[model samples]
Target: SADETLAHLQAALKRRRRLSDQAQMLVRKAMAYIHSHYTHPLTRQDIAHYVGMSEDYLTHCFRQELGTTPVEYLNRYRVLQARHLLAESDKSITNIALEVGFSSSSYFSRVFRKEVGQSPEEYRRLKQSSVR
Candidate 1:
């Protein structure tokens, strides 16, 4: 009886691990949508349809695997792109924000500050000062 119980437990554990991997794969696929379309305004429904899953399923996979929602991930990616533009290009903050799919400069600045710990102007000034 003990042997049989151990075998059943092991099988269940293996199944759970396999399901976890599958969920991770789904999350990775969702993340790819951002990478492939970071410059465009993409929606959660768009990503879900692209992956052939419901929006709720995609969101669950993302949160379960990555500990964040799809929008959160997209915001991080957008901020990363903004950082690159700030460092590598002479684009104005508003233009950079719009180009990176943010709806407005104010929202972009808010999210950027939350992630980068500085307003876009401050970030640019700091980086520029370091360069000189």
Candidate 2:
């Protein structure tokens, strides 16, 4: 009986390992898809469609794998790109927001402050002052 129980546990462990590997691969694929399409408006539905899964399932899977929802990940990525543009380009804040795929400049400002602890203008000013 002990040997049989050990064998069953080993088999179950193997199955879990296989599923974990698959989830890892799917997360990687979803991240790659986000990196490529983040410049455009994206939704959880869009990511699910690209990954060939339902939105609910993709959300659960992505959250489990990455500890954040896909939408949140996209927003963070957008903010990162916006930071670069803000520091280097003379583009308007609204333009930078739109270029980074935010739907509205106010929304961009809100999210940017949330993520960076500063508004885009403040960030740009700080960066420019430091460079001089």
Candidate 3:
């Protein structure tokens, strides 16, 4: 009974190890693109091309590993950067939007709300309030 239990545990652990390894490789490539060019109006197609896969394939891989598409990931990342600028920089929201790859402030506000549950202005208000 002890030997069987040990074997089962070992098998489970091995499966988890293999899955994590594969997931890490997928995320590593995705993040490489995100970090290097988050400011450059990158697209899912660009990431797919960089990784030598079709856009659909890259989307599937990203969803399997990160539970989201690359575009969603990048959008959230941009919103995060916008949050920082809102809190720390004198830049206007429009300027911050452009800085973070959003082509328009209105569009950035839309996506920011979708990802962050609030408009960028509201996020900044909350952040500023918390700091006081």
* Candidate whose lDDT is highest: 2
For model 3, residues 18-120, the per-residue Cα lDDT tens digits are: 3455545655666677867888979888888887778887787666655578898788778877888998877889999999999899999999999889988
TM-score of each: 0.82, 0.83, 0.80
Off-target runs (Cα >4 Å) in candidate 3 are: 1-26
Clashes of each: 0, 0, 0
Q: List the residue pairs that clash in candidate 1.
A: none
Highest TM-score: give the candidate number: 2
What TM-score does candidate 3 get on C-alpha atoms?
A: 0.80
User: Which residue segments of model 2 deviate by more than 4 Å?
Assistant: 1-19
TM-score of candidate 2 on Cα atoms, chains taken together: 0.83
> In candidate 1, what are the lDDT values of residues 42-99, reduced to their tens digit?
8999888887888898887766555567888788889988887898789999999999
RMSD of 3: 9.3
Question: What TM-score does candidate 1 reach?
Answer: 0.82
Q: Pick out the ten consecutive residues of candidate 1 with the lowest summed lDDT.
A: 1-10
Cα deviation of 9, candidate 2, in Å: 28
lDDT of 1: 0.79
Of 1 and 2, the candidate ahead on TM-score is: 2
